[model samples]
Target chain A: DTAVSQTPKYLVTQMGNDKSIKCEQNLGHDTMYWYKQDSKKFLKIMFSYNNKELIINETVPNRFSPKSPDKAHLNLHINSLELGDSAVYFCASSQDRGRMKQYFGPGTRLTVT
Target chain B: AQTVTQSQPEMSVQEAETVTLSCTYDTSENNYYLFWYKQPPSRQMILVIRQEAYKQQNATENRFSVNFQKAAKSFSLKISDSQLGDTAMYFCAFMKREQGAQKLVFGQGTRLTINP
Candidate 1:
């Protein structure tokens, strides 16, 4: 069984469109995170949630928002997506808040045209 | 702020040979954790190994081992008996022991190719 899973492995959308990427973890982890891997393959954290509460918010634009309905699900919503938003989005989860090992899901490739 | 650096952008090794991927980090806090992650063409990030700062002994996982130098602030990954399956983009990461919230800082990454 997949510990962490993301829907729509590949997403292709036009600029100014709104899109949502869903992530779910079966590991019963309390912490979940969203990371963006740009064209240069530099992975950066965009947001993090702990037990359905927002914990960490990077310097991401206001157009992007993350919602966690429960400890097992974290979803990312991007509004008015721009060309620069084209990149791979990764979802990860860990058991604790400290520096613990994380389990990542198969990334979602989002191409904004 | 913590930073992880993988000096080698790319590396290649013949099958059955051993290869080492170097990684160095900078941090003010004395307590933290280090990790080595591998991402193949499938773009799935997999944890190769992890090392805790308080532990003096190095960490080893099967064919993978890490040389953790706390004073030098270096953590390098060594792969023995390299196989083609080992070819992937290796990332070195750091995690601070912060309360409530914790995040990983990843290096630029090193692409290792294992040729048979």
Candidate 2:
């Protein structure tokens, strides 16, 4: 069983188009996060959502929004995607906010032309 | 802000040999966690090993072990009898112990190559 799974393993889209990435965790986690790895392989947190609130990094642009339909799912939607948006996005989940061990899903490689 | 640094941008090891990857972090918080994650060509982020801040003893999992120096704020990973499948991008990460501090501060990553 896949503990964490993400859809659209690879995505290609135009610069101005909007795109979305879907993530689901069957591990019954209470916290989910989104991280981006640039071409340099520098990974940084974009957003984190728990059962109650969504915590976002100020560095992330407003075009990106994270929606957690439930504790097990966290979807990211990017508006007016730019060339800079071309990177690998990873979804991760932890048993809870207190649990430090996180399980990551196979990343989604998004390429914006 | 907490930051994880992997000074070595790349490393190589021969099959059946051992190699060490160094990592250092800067943080003001005393309670936190350190982790080593491996991402293979398939691009799946796999947790290789983990170390708790308060634990003075290093953590080891079979062939993977960590040298965690809490005072020095250094955590290094040692791989024994490296295999070709060990070739991947290894990232060091830090997480605060506080509840909901789930965001991981990751290093740029060090590309490890296991030669046959």
Candidate 3:
């Protein structure tokens, strides 16, 4: 079983369109995160949720939003996608007090045309 | 804001040889966590190793090990007897020891290739 899994591993959409990526973790983790990896392979944290509460929201654009229906699931919705948004999006999770390990999913490769 | 830096953009090692990937980070928090993640061609982020700031003893897992210099703010990964399976993109990540969710600050990553 996959510890963390994301749907739509590779997504392609036109610019200005809306898309969403869903994530789930079977590791009984309470904290989940969304990260973006740019073309240069630079990874940056976009959002973090702990037990369905928003914890960390970096200086990301307003078009990006994260929803956590429960502690086990976190979904990302993007509005008015742009070419600059084309990158690999990753979902990660860790236990409530897990300070050393964060399990990650096979990232979603989003393409904005 | 804490930042992780992986100076080596790429590295290559022959099979059964050894390779070292360097990483450095800057953070204001005294107690934190450092990690090495491996991303293979399948594009999955796999935890290779982890080190806590409070622990002076280095962490080792089979063929993977880490040299954590807390005072120097440097954490490097050493792979002994590198195998073809070890070829992947290695990332250095840092997370604060806060009470809630941990936001991982990741480095640019180092691409490692193991030759046969």
Task: Compute the lDDT of residue B72 as modeled in candidate 3.
Answer: 96
lDDT of each: 0.93, 0.89, 0.92
Per-residue lDDT for A16-83 in model 3, tens only? 99999999999999899999999998889899998899988889999999999999999999999999
Error of 2 at A43 (Å): 0.9
**Poorly placed runs, candidate 2 (over 4 Å):** A97-99
Two-chain complex of model 2, DockQ on C-alpha atoms against the true structure: 0.72
Q: What is the interface RMSD of each candidate, in Å?
A: 1.2, 1.5, 1.2
lDDT of 3 by residue, B4-115 (tens): 8999999988999989999999988887889999989898888899888999999999999999999899999999999999999999999884558777889999999999
TM-score of chain B of 2: 0.96
Ranking by lDDT: 1, 3, 2
**Model 1 docking grade:** medium
Model 3 residue B97 lDDT?
A: 46
- Give TM-scores of the second chain, every candidate: 0.97, 0.96, 0.97
Worst 10 residues of 2 chain B by lDDT: B95-104
- Candidate 3 is graded, for docking, as high
Tens-digit lDDT track of model 2 for B1-116: 89889999999888999999999999989878899999998888889998889888899999999989888999999999999999999999998743564668998899999999
- True-vs-predicted CA distance for residue A101, candidate 2, Å: 0.9
